[model samples]
Target: MLRRAPRECGSWWWDLDDVTETGLVPALGTAARMAAVLGKHALLEPSSLEWDWFERGRGGLGVHTRLGLMGSRLDDPELAEQARACRPVGHPAAEMSALLVTGPGERLDAEGEPRREPRLVELTVSPDPYGCWAEVAVHHDVWSPCDFGGEPHPAVHANNAPRLAAALRALDALLGVPGEPGEPTYFGVAEGHGLKAPELVDGLGPDLTDLL
Candidate 1:
């Protein structure tokens, strides 16, 4: 089983308010384009989508929905309609909030064998009319220079960080908007197209295994 961090190690956000329209259809379109770039880099394959519903003034209704792709691509013309049809009958006024795109992501294991890990890279897009944005986040330590135990893992970092950076660069080019580094966490921080190196202490990075 894959060990996932309780919170994201690093995240990147893209404000698409100017470039993309805000709505279910347009959000899905953006997700399709973003997923394509991630898939090309073996980051996310987009097998399903999950979201919560909210009303303009009433806030969240605590209602959540999940839709399995069942081999349907995110770009499929029918996907947006299928998603819209899932709205709760009790909350007709509710609108979709941020939609989460999930799928198996490729990760090299202890022996360097590629393994499919679910939710390896999480992608979310907000369809709110007020403002539109998208975010990509990673939890595992593969993108970092050291493991949770403060042990250096240059090989793992080399193999994974570049792929994630390339994917982010591709996403920037595709969306025509540069990604902004998200907030820092105890685990790590996002810098440029990759993670910012944690401050070292006596030649070792911070031991974050306690949080893990």
Candidate 2:
């Protein structure tokens, strides 16, 4: 089952042309826990590997992929063991931009240094363009003022606005935490998977509209 922490990051993300229908995806079965909210309701439960999303640069975008707090939490033994068993998302990566990171939180070096800033992401999962879909906790920090080892995708600041708005909405719906409604990139977007916003009264910080 997919593991989720109630007190952990509250967030969401998705593709450029996708929408709620396409965004409502399956969780990786390997997820030991998960929390989801549809409409005005909330649901937290065990997840499956089938819910995972694949990371494929299609050999150009940028350094793409993710490592959660669960990754370094191996000292706990229980989570480390489970993280090692994570299953591949298996979805076709044929259309992914260079390196796109998904999920919440910020990037860290081996010594736990802030690798770079954060970003609000947007993507189109299919070969054919369409409406928006799905939401992710964090995404590729391409827009940050960091080096992508000299990659080929656009920087994070160049991200589309509509897509970011959609991602924020998705996260708010699932996490059930609204952001401080305001302009785009109010939080600077990137920082790994930053699901919980500090601007929120409940400590979740900001509403999805906060970024609009």
Candidate 3:
């Protein structure tokens, strides 16, 4: 089971169990474990045979998961600290090459023409190890033809599924905020706002092009 405690309160937690696993594609169990820490299901019931809790619907799991991974949320009193220590498969740098992509409400879902106006964020963490795990997202719109190539394509299942779910939770928290995004905004926006993109760069102003 995975739980997220607000960094400040150090008491908040999101439970991940079989329910979360059931909803997730098998390939991404570890990522789902990360996601489990991000949300609570409306209804939870332990399977008699499996003997584990089953949660329904992800709700706000996605964004919080990302925030948890980003580590910035640790500063928020409203957010929770991880119930347990998270030793990642490996250490991940806080910043990457470029842009952050906006999902759902941030972008329009058309069947074609992604380049026409641009439709991805920068520096995402792809769930697929074979693919770029950094540029990952679950927002499967028609515009993207899984062009990026990776394990967990927004809709496809992969080993990093749990991680992707956790990332979503972290991201959701940032969206919940009302004012301007603060400091070192790693993600990118498409031309001010008309279109959305992924977070390609870790720090928008830093310009790590040559350094990276």
Candidate 4:
């Protein structure tokens, strides 16, 4: 079964039992590289990463943070240091946390120019030594105008949903696992699976009026 994300934006997630690479730092690097392949312009600086954690039990913990990146600098040394810094100390032997990163993605228009604004797409990873999971969130306003009900315009879905699918494909290639598409969020599923168009749903998700 697919897990529901806390937010109602365009979101997809994966719970991987065999994350070849472990540790928060390594996971961040992998996420950044994947973002780069998706044409993300830059990675959110490490210093800007806001992290929080709490103990769940003896040697168990939970972590959560929203990370941002920009300008395609995944290899920046300083950024790496910041990612390491974000790792909590005295953490449990096992933990689960969602790492979110957002930056500019490549989405061209009919004129072959960028159709979406900078930092419109978001990527997430829930990395753990034993296993991990990840998610992606996109604010519809970043693509186009929405109605009071929070449905993106048809043109917006046409342009952005496919981009989300392509990015998910790239991520799957990296993970070596075909991710199961989650329930349709505010936007839609990213798994193209040979379907025509971006295959958007009929109704709006939870009220995102203020978020838009």
In terms of TM-score, the best-performing candidate is 1
lDDT score, candidate 3, position 193? 11
Off by over 4 Å in 3: 1-80, 85-105, 109-135, 145-212
Per-residue lDDT over 83-104 for candidate 2, one digit per residue giving the tens place of the 0 to 100 score:
3344334543533321222332
- lDDT string for model 1 (41-97, tens) is 999999999999888889999989999999998868799889999999998888998
**Cα RMSD, model 4:** 6.7
- Candidate 1 least-lDDT 10 residues: 107-116
- lDDT tens digits, residues 170-191, model 4? 7777777776655655433333
Each candidate's number of clashing pairs is 0, 65, 65, 11
The alpha-carbon deviation from the true structure for residue 128 of candidate 3, after best TM-score superposition, in angstroms, is 16
* TM accuracy, model 2: 0.21
How much is 110 displaced in model 2, in angstroms?
A: 29
Clashing pairs in 1: none
The local distance difference test score of model 3 is 0.23
Worst 10 residues of 2 by lDDT: 38-47
lDDT (C-alpha) at residue 197 in model 4: 28
lDDT of 3 by residue, 81-109 (tens): 23112213232221111112222112222
* lDDT of candidate 3 at residue 194, scale 0 to 100: 15
Stretches off by above 4 angstroms in model 1 are 109-112
